[model samples]
Target: MPFENICIFGAGALGGTIAAKLAASGNVDATISVVARGAHLDAIRRSGISLFEAGADKPLLANVTATNDPTELPPQDLIITGLKGHQLAPAAEGLAHLLKPSTRVVMILNGIPWWYFHRDESNHAELQFEELDPGGKLWRLIGPERVIGCVAIQGAEVSDPGQIRLSNKGRFILGEPSGDISADLREIEALLNRAEISVTLSERIRDDIWSKLMGNASFNPISALTRSRMSDLMADGATSDQIGKVMKEVKAVGEALGANVGISVEERLEQASQVGPIKTSMLQDLLAGKPLEITPLVGMIVALGRLTAVPTPVSETILALVSQLDRENCRTA
Candidate 1:
């Protein structure tokens, strides 16, 4: 069977987009389920999953299953955990009983994944960064075997619980966490492609993830701390230079950890420059009075520096600045 019953762990912006496309493809036989709670759940259940199909001004609604309790959902073939970083633990908690042996969980979160380099024969292989998976809850519950790493470059946000505004790029890079091709990976790629979303099946998924992380770790926190946009930050020579330092640190850490990301620091910076000025998701979270995904986004880089015996001068500095801002943001709100 080709994954007829799929359940999304979160019913926010990204989940809605994926649900709409997957439903449209006729890949799955039944209605897709969106696991949610309270107002978000109510809105989705009552109004259906809505998205800007191909960036249209209006939303395209698809009939979907939305609910608060996972127990109410059947054991599904696929479960994509489209959650904020902080929501990982809770999602896992709910998932313990909801997933079956056949279900493959696609972890589509940003920043350093908890299972990176887990089975590699490198120096930093098998070293689990406790800062990201502090209690090892995610690591233990969701094994490396079931995970497919996603380098999600798309940008969309829930304009409200009922609708999601598709604002920018919708492409994502996918790979098995162990960097090996398998049946599940192929199935997912086919489903995504059938749904009209751009996906690249990557061999070096970790490197692609690290590349995006370098920009995210440096740019996201810096933007939030200074309240600036991408163009202004990339335009100023000094700021851009600071970002370069952070990327250098990221490269050093990745190299020491035995994951060879073969991109020069300046090349990475140039790639980030071409993306144009866009507001980061972290800033959106802050303005929405939600907890920032600081630990996984920026903290894991600093944590990796310590694990790999590398000096992270720039990442450390940026982490400190962002940490202070996050603390203040939490304190007042």
Candidate 2:
């Protein structure tokens, strides 16, 4: 069955970009809507969503129903959540109105997801990460069965209230946590492809998560602490070596938990070097006076290291430093 009603909840930055792209595509046969708040919502309501891609002279505009309340929209066939890992738990209850029995929730999140252990046969199966999910609110309200794991390799930022700036053209990797190529997954892949968004179906989404985390866990915090770009960090010999150490530790923890990162530390560093001097999301958040994504990116790795009896000395040190930095920024802001 085709998705009839598609909603982009927490449409900010990457989410907003996805919504705008889908709306502008003119190929999707679904009713598109966005749930946003405050000035962004107002702007989207006033003029729809505008996307400014890199090197594009003019922005792409798309009109869609924009609302702050989930109840104002119909029950959706697909709910793509762009909320940060920390923000999901608090908003889970409010999002209930958008879900029916078969609604699929695609979480475009970084680090280890809350439903990482769901449907797994390992000792950690069904275990919840308090750092990400907190008091199991998401588990109780949203349920893992409705989740479709997604790893987004996109770079986007909200240039203004309702305007999105795309840094690069990136693709999304989607999969079922249970490792099944179900009907819903195929439908979503086709829908996104129709909208001209690159999509890849992965059989092992957890491994994809770890593959992305290899760079995120190391570079995000390092960038935050040093206030440097990817190129800057990769250019300096000492900083590059430090990033490699952190990646090694993160890879070790993932391996202990049966995730294959599938790349060497040098290869990962080379990839980062190719991205040039891009400001990591952590660094960008720090500059914007927003709360840093500490837990999912770094803290979760440290926690998992402990759970799997893997030593994360470098990750631990970086976590402590970046966490303190986040607290100090919050205190000042």
Candidate 3:
């Protein structure tokens, strides 16, 4: 059965892009609702979600019901969280209101999630990650069974209130944490495919997770610290070397925790180079004065490294610096 009602919670750039794509696709058999806040919600309610793709002159208006309150919406058949990793914990309970017994939650945010380490039942005793979950609020409220992991490879940003501009297009990698091709995964893939968004399934989602996280953990912080784009980060040899060190430590931690990243550090850096001068989401967030999403991207990996006894000094240092930057930025705000 297809999801009858899909709610997009935290409808910011990435979420808005996905919601706009889906809502514009007439063939998808679902009612798409966007739970957003502030001026974005007001704009969407006044007008629809205005989306502009890279090569297009005009924006497409996606007719999604937009509101600030989750309580105003029906119990969603599927809920996609489009918020940053740091935003999830605070909204966990509010997100719970949109869930029914059978609702599935897909988190398409960047970096490792609170649910990443707890997919295995046998290791239930070892699944607690206080760094990401902070008293296991998300884990307890959302649970692992209803959670599906996603690696959002697309790049997008809000050019204005209720407007999403897609800077680049890429596939969304979807998977079950237990490495199974279940019915739920297929349904979500079909829906996204209908939206004309590329979708792929990963047998070992952890490998895909680590592969994306490798770049995010390394490049995102460096870019934020220096306010540089991918092109600049790749151009300078010294900063590029630092990125490699961070990725190497990340690879060790991933392997220690049974994830095969399947990409070499040099190859990953080369791939980053080809992506051009894209400002990382972290850098963008910092410039926008929003709180940095430090935990899931770098801090949680450091926490995982501690669990598996893997040394992550490079990541540890980067985490400390970026964390301090976040604190000082937030202090004056």
Q: Which pairs of residues collide in model 2?
A: none
Model 2: per-residue Cα lDDT at residue 79: 94
Model 1 Cα lDDT, one tens digit per residue, 1-333 = 367788888867776688777775655465588787767678877877678754487667777877888888888888887887778876676876666787788878788877786766675567676666768887788766777888887877777776777767678888886778877888888887877878888877888877787788888888787777777788889988888888888877777766668788888778767766667778777787667888887787888788777888777887888788778888888
- Kindly list the per-residue Cα lDDT of model 3 for residues 210-298, writing each as its tens digit: 99989999989999999999999999999999999999999998888777899999899888889887888998888878899998899
* Superposed Cα deviation of residue 24, candidate 2 (Å): 1.3
- Supply the global lDDT for candidate 1: 0.77
Cα lDDT listed for each candidate:
0.77, 0.90, 0.86
How far off is residue 264 in model 2, in Å? 0.8
Best by TM-score: 2
Model 2, 1-333: lDDT tens digits are 668899999899878988998889879888999999989999999999989987687999999899988888989989999988877887887677898998999999999889999987678889887778878888988899999999999888787889988888889999999999999999999899999899999999999999999999999999999999999999999999999999999899998999888998889988898997688888888998889988999998889999999999999899899989999999999
How many residue pairs clash in model 1? Answer: 0
RMSD per candidate (Å) reads: 2.1, 1.2, 1.6
The segments of candidate 3 whose C-alpha lies over 4 angstroms from its true place after superposition are: 121-126
Ranking of candidates on lDDT, top first = 2, 3, 1
Q: Looking at candidate 2, what is the lDDT of residue 130?
A: 78
Q: How accurate locally is residue 316 in candidate 1, as Cα lDDT from 0 to 100?
A: 80
